[model samples]
Target: MESLQALQDFIKTKDNFRNFVNSSEVPSVCKTEPCMLGVDEAGRGPVLGPMVYGVAYCPLSQTSVLKDLGCADSKALTEEKRDDIFRKMLTEEASLNNVGWAAEIISPNYISNSMYRRAKHSLNEVSMNSAIDLIKKVAESGANITEVYVDTVGPPEKYQAKLSEIYPNYKITVAKKADSIYPIVSAASIVAKVTRDHALKVWQFKEGLEMTHAEFGSGYPGDPLTKKFIREQVDYVFGYPMLVRFSWSTAELMLQDKAATCTFEEIDDELPKKKVKSISSFFSVKSEDGAMKRKRHKFFEERYLSMDNAFE
Candidate 1:
C-alpha cells in the first residue's frame, strides 16, 4: 500500500480486484533468470472483508534476497512487525530489486456467489484457481518459471498433482505450512495479510451502516465483535451487507436467529422435470421403443366400458 489516503482512494464497489507490485523494480534481465514462485493466502477463515491470494516470485538463484529481507513465518510476527517488513520490501533497494508480487482480493460477495452456485464451487477451489491464475499471469508476462511452492491446508498431493498437470514444465511443490518453511511463501503471506488488512480498513459500506472494522472484530466467527455485528447490524430482509460472506454458517445462523424470517422457494425450472412415468404405465401400454407410452386419463371411460348393463 502507498498510503492510508491511497488505500482509501483505491476502495471500489467492485467485488474483486487485483494488483501487481515491484514488477519494474526487478531488472529486465532478471526475467530470464530461473524464477521460483510462491503462493499463499490470507483471510480464508474470516467471514469479513476479502480473502486475498498472493504470489511472490524471484530468481531461483537469488533466494538469499528474501532471507535478507526477513521474510519468515508471518504468523510469528506482530501486526506492526509485518507492516514494517512489507514497507521495507517496498522501499528498500536490495529487496525491491529481487521480488515481484501480485495479489487477488477475492471479495466476500464472490465467495458467497461461488459457494451458493447451483454446482457449488468450494472455497478451496476458488483459492486454488486464484493461485493458478496468478502463477500463469506471471509466467505469461515472461518470467522464466522453473519451480512453484504453495502453502496449503488441504492434502498436498492432490494440489501438487493438479498444478503439475497445468504447468508441467515447472517443478511444483504444495505443502502444509510452506509459509513457515519457504521464505518466498512467507513474503507472499505478508503481502496477502497486509492487503486484506487494508481492504478491511477501508471497507466502504453500501448498505448505509454506520460502523467500522473495530466493531466487527477480526471477522472470525469466534470474534466477539463479529458475532455482535451479525446479531446487531442486520437488515430485516437482506441480513448483512455485501462485505459479509452469507454462505458462511456463522452469518447464516445468526441471521436466521436474529433477523427476519426468510424463506426460499426452490424453483425446479428444468423443463418441468422429465415426468417419470408412473409404475402403472408399464402395465398399461408399451411404445415402439419398448417403454411406457404415456396415455391420457381414461378412468370414467374404462368404468362405463366394463359395466354389464347400463343401469347396473
Candidate 2:
C-alpha cells in the first residue's frame, strides 16, 4: 500500500517536472546569414503515388517568423499538425514555392528501375527548374540571392554537378539534413508533404479505391499499410491501376510469383524459350581475343517505357 501511494505521488508530480523542463531559457531563433534559398524533397520511397519536391526562399529578414511558426522537420509532426502548419505557411508566407513530380502508371516489371532512374531524374529536374524560376522571380523583385541550399538526395557533389548542368549562373550548396538545419528547408518539407497528401487523395478518388484512415502513410516501405496495399494490388486479377509504379522490384516479384502459379501449358512452354536469349547473337557481339564486345552498348541497356508505351 505504501509503494502504491508513492507511485501515485510520482505520477502527480509529472506536470511539475514538465513545467520545469519547459522553463529552460533559450533564444527563439538561431542567427543565419541572409538571402539563402533552402530546398528539400518528399515522397521518394512510396510504393504508390508521385514523388513531390519543394523549395523555399527565406530572405533572413523573416527568421523570427519561421521561429514563431515552429518551423521544423515535417516528419516530426502529426498529419493534422502538418496540415495546420502547411495552411499557416501558405496563408502567411509569400516566398515559398512547391512543386511535384507525378509518375503515372507503367507495367509492374519496370517500376523499381524506372522509379530509381526516371522518377528521380524527373524529380531532380523539376526541383532545379523550380528553384531557378523562384530565384529569378525573387531577383526581379529586387531581392538578392547569394546562395542556395538543398537537402542532398544522392550526393552533395552530384547536386552541384546537376545544378551546374541545369543552371550554370547560380551558386548552390547541397548537404544532407539541410531540412533539419535550415528553416527554409523545413518549410519546403511541409509544402512537399502537404502537396503529396493532396495529390494522393485526388488519385485515390480518381481511381475509385477506398482506403481506411491508416491506409495512406508517408508511403515508406516501413509502413505495414503500404506493404499491404502493394500486396493486394499485385495479386489483383484485373491488373494494376494506372497509379502504380509497375517497374518496382516488389511488383515484378509479385508478378513472377503469380505467373509461376498458373497451370497453362502454353505459358509454360513460352516461358523457357523466352528465358534462353542468345545474347551474343542478339547484340551481334564479336568473340575476339576470348572476349565478347558489342558494337553498341545502348542496344543492351534497359529501355525506359512510359505509361502509354507500357500497355502496348
Tell me the tens digit of each residue's lDDT in model 2 across 1-312. 112233224323432111110010111221133455666666666666555555555555655666666768888888787776665544323223221111111212233344477436444454455455544544454444566777876677977787766656557777889888877778767766765565555343234567743565545666787777667765445445545555555555776766344555666656555456676577575677877765544534457544467678
TM-score of each: 0.80, 0.57
Please list the C-alpha lDDT of all candidates, in the order they appear: 0.79, 0.53
Worst 10 residues of 2 by lDDT: 17-26
Tens-digit per-residue lDDT, 1-312, candidate 1: 344345445555343333323222444545878988889999999887788888788888888888877888777888888877676655545345578777788878889989999999999999899899988878878777899999985799999999999999999999999999999999999878877887787777877777777878889888988888877877877788887899999888888887789567777764467878778766775669877565645985776554457566
* Model 2 global lDDT (CA atoms, 0 to 1): 0.53
Best by lDDT: 1
Candidate 2: list runs displaced more than 4 Å.
1-34, 92-144, 164-169, 205-207, 235-238, 259-312
List pairs with backbone clashes in candidate 2. 108-246, 110-247, 111-246, 111-247, 111-248, 112-247, 112-248
